[model samples]
Target: MKPRSRPTLARRLASGLATLVVLAGVAVANRPMVAVAGEALHTYQINRESYKKRYGHWARLPVPHDFRVNAIHAALLHTGKVLIIAGSGNNRDAFEEKSFRTVLFDPGTEEFTEVPTPTDVFCAGHTFLPNGNLLVAGGTKSYEVLEADVEHAAGVMKIKNESPDHGDRVFDKGTRLRSPAGLIYLTRTRVTVPAARKVTHGAHIMVHAGAAEVWVDAEQKGDGAVVQDPAQYTIDGLTGDDAKNLYGVADKITREKQEYGGDRTSYEFDPVAERYVRTGNMRDHRWYPTLIGLTNGEVLAVSGLDQFGRILPGRNERYLPGERRWVRAPELKRYFPTYPSLHMMADGQVFYSGSNAGYGSDTEGRTPGVWDVERNRFRAVPGLRDPRMTETSSSVLLAPAQDQKVMILGGGEIGESPVSTARTDIVDLDERQPRYRPGPDLPKPARYLSTVLLPDDTVFTTGGSSGYRGGAYRGEPRSDLFNSQIYRPAENAFATAADSTVGRNYHSEAILLPDGRVITLGGDPLYDETGKNAGTFEQRIEVFSPPYLFRGTRPTMAGGPTEISRDETASFATPDAARITSARLIRPSSVTHVTDTDQRSVAVDVVPAAGGVEITVPKRAGLVPSGWYMLFLIDDRGVPSVARWVRVR
Candidate 1:
């Protein structure tokens, strides 16, 4: 046998270099595969029993195709059913077809039924009356037209009748009016002007003209028909005395953007009958208003765009629930941006949390304050960081209504500016001079985040986007966040929870259910994942069971009084009385667009009785507003029992 000779030095070096190149190529090719494997491992770990028991779990609800809706507004009724309203669902075609919809969902039965919606309640305001009826008021009377889409210049025209003997004058649609420039404009709808009335003085008499306003569009399209200055227009068909008696006046007629017009219709949704009962109409048409139930059982409606597509100038009204009518609240005149977060305080004063849906003048009504509606006095509160980013913020009165503390969560820049903040501010209203103080920051900048107060006294926040309606942020195409966190007020810190599968942003809501789970629904994103196509509304509902629910068996409540009065004691039968540690009387949420003034948890004094527990309701009307509440008994493990419906009088 002969021994083999060694290779040349050049050959050896080439072979070694080839080996290194192949290894580098292999490492580069396996990078994506390694990432996938790591993601799979993390998923499996999170799904394990130990991880779920610690971080909680999320499950999606099965909704039938026939029962699906856009869910613009949602309220949990006293009958343990959820009322979802989608009047036209923000779809212009649906509004044109008058296809309004409302649906009732029973979580226990997992059943859904459609309720006939008579009007377009999209962008309406609602609050719960003392009788447990939900009063829904104001909605979209007309959709907005952008400047680019405006083919004809338009403006509101005031028609005056100066002749006292002419009686009522009627003009049908398409009635033409001619300006001094000879430009013609046609009325969009019929107009009726009342006859002028003669006023008598001690020695003289004067006639006051009667006027009616109607929307009028330019007869011809283009800048030629645009009128920049206020002008008096003559009625085209009128002649001689009729022409002098009736004339049209308009401030401007230009192809500018037109805002959404408001509707004056109102209704009371009867939970027992499962139907909407017609109520008296509001005096002023409103869109994006806030109808908040006062301590006296009346509802105060404030801030919205009126029928003429103009922001109401400090006009507010009150709804008398018993009389079923609305009257102007001239004395309570105060302006705010649309859908302002107004929380009723224990002393009947309302606290404006500085959180509002984007609308109105940016600087005028953006101040945080305590408004004394009775005296028409407002005192501003300072120390709010990133105050300008409060347009889409969420504000909640912290747990234990007696604390009188409010926390404002993440928000974005005014309008659709694509800027967001992670800052959270808390204010103790019980202070002599209430001012906001900074709290822990969120994990990431967020907007339209939904915050739900759980029965265990913890606030669970989840599902928001870092951009404008989940569009673009920091150069990312879409920015809907799935991360969930539980904020422990006691610790003043946030703990990670299991991530949700769905992406929720604008038009989303998180409601705490009677069974100790948070149900989340509705998301209207501006763009899809590719950031090129329009996004669709999220119809799938997700339910979150907190970590406590996965810990062990929950406490059970068997019997309880159906109704209780303020400052009174009530007893209820409970199987796990020994383990029961605390009691919470939580108001069910009537929420939309992160604006829910109806939700506040009242801590009740609990004492263990024979095989049950006794709880006392607070005496102050502002502390516990008259309405239906869910009473939950929490055990030592921080697990809440199934709630029992209890009405507070």
Candidate 2:
């Protein structure tokens, strides 16, 4: 055979063009076709569809209080009521007055009932117990501050041999007082004393006498000594960093400080009584801790600022539902970053996804890995290109809880950086050698994004800011993003959904309701539309009705066992058993900071029966954790009926 003859230039060009045409056709077919307000658009564009046939629509709900009271934390209870915890609302006035507020919202009645918090639970960590009670731990003890004013004195130095109550002491000439960090001032003059002593207690060096005042800085724990006053020389003054430091003072004063101490108080909210009852407190004070439910029906509390606003390393504790107390878990040697996103593996292990809220250093508990609770050992899983960017990132166990796959979405830099990344990555824990693989990038770099897993096996993400904590943007309306997107795991693609009426950013939350709708609430933008310092809290509640709601009529579910046994077929009555295609058990949410590891949607194996349907609950506690879950019946068109409450044990 003759050597391969070179093809003509025209033939080569034709072949290339044909190949391009085929590739283009494939791209067009694979790309998601999104319909926005009756207009079709490709997946690459931002589609503003308030009402789309295949997308969700947001409806503003009328709250009894007119607005949500700065809802920083929200949880769905088994009684179909939402527990909104405001806890001083992050306001200085409210915090100072000890106005810790909480409310129970009844979606069915559209009413809100005020619940009293025994202590300030602001910025605390919470999770639902197997008994359907919410266990909230840690909070603010007092607002710590530092300032120069006399009201905000740092400490008190008593003059040696001087009357503790009386003042106006005598000092010698050429005497000087010094403070390492703050200024020394005369309490009577209200003026800072010069570093060098030009004058003394007396007129001359022979027997000069003068009264001296020393003003120390706030948070100063040392005592100042008198330099002069040769005749029984003594100098004393009051000093402290903040109000909490005012130990012996009777007057109440406010001081300027950046940090606050964490509280060791804990409470359990009873849905039936609609009240928060004081429970056993934690061993260590924890602020911004992450509470995750374990497979054994206990809650693990990890990572938080201590009473002095310092990162608490190796301070792990477990909450017992029966005892209603938090016990130390000293075996857990590994420390986690603040608010680390933890998910339970099928084999009863906890996986830290390296996604933290804020605070903590890279060298301290920032590694991502699967943690063995029994052994207290961590198996590190590398492959995250930008592990440092996991701050404020969102991670979720993909649809069908049994999949054992976790996907982490957009996040920002370690600290309060304006920079954010749209990159996404996923890891399959089921693999023999698990490692992270690149996933689809987000439409935009977002922080504080709320990821809600829908009943239709689709992940719905909404409400995040392009800036740090939803501020510091270059365009109009600041940094908040109202756009929403849906992630389809089957296609591994993201499609534009509906745009929310209000923008949400930091301190915001979104959770799935029993009726197959999502309720988005509480956003603190930090600034107003004019870029001014305005505490713009998005208090309006917006409910999103998923596209499945518009897909014809929904099936009706009734008469299911209140409690379910593992590995057993539970029977339930459905209006259309032939049309029922799937059954799912969704754990009720106790979400905050976009880190809710307790919420999981487990798909149950369903089969048609003589009356309704027989659903088999997984025997493994890791698959269907011992707790209350909402049982939903989905029709062939993927429309789910109103969920009925069921306890899995």
Task: Give the Cα lDDT of each candidate.
Answer: 0.92, 0.76
lDDT of candidate 2 at residue 488, scale 0 to 100: 93
Enumerate clash totals for all models, in the order shown.
Answer: 0, 19
Q: State the weakest 10-residue window (summed lDDT) of model 2.
A: 244-253
Specify the highest-lDDT model's number.
Answer: 1
Which residue pairs clash within candidate 1? Answer: none
TM-score of candidate 1 to 2 decimals: 0.93
Candidate 1 wrong stretches, greater than 4 Å: 1-43, 200-202
Question: Model 1, residue 173: displacement in angstroms?
Answer: 1.9
Runs in model 2 deviating more than 4 A are: 1-51, 144-257, 474-477
Candidate 1 lDDT tens digits, 525-573? 9999999999999989999988988888999999889999999999899
lDDT of 2 by residue, 344-442 (tens): 888899989888887777667777888989899888988886777888899999879999999999888888788888888999999877888998998
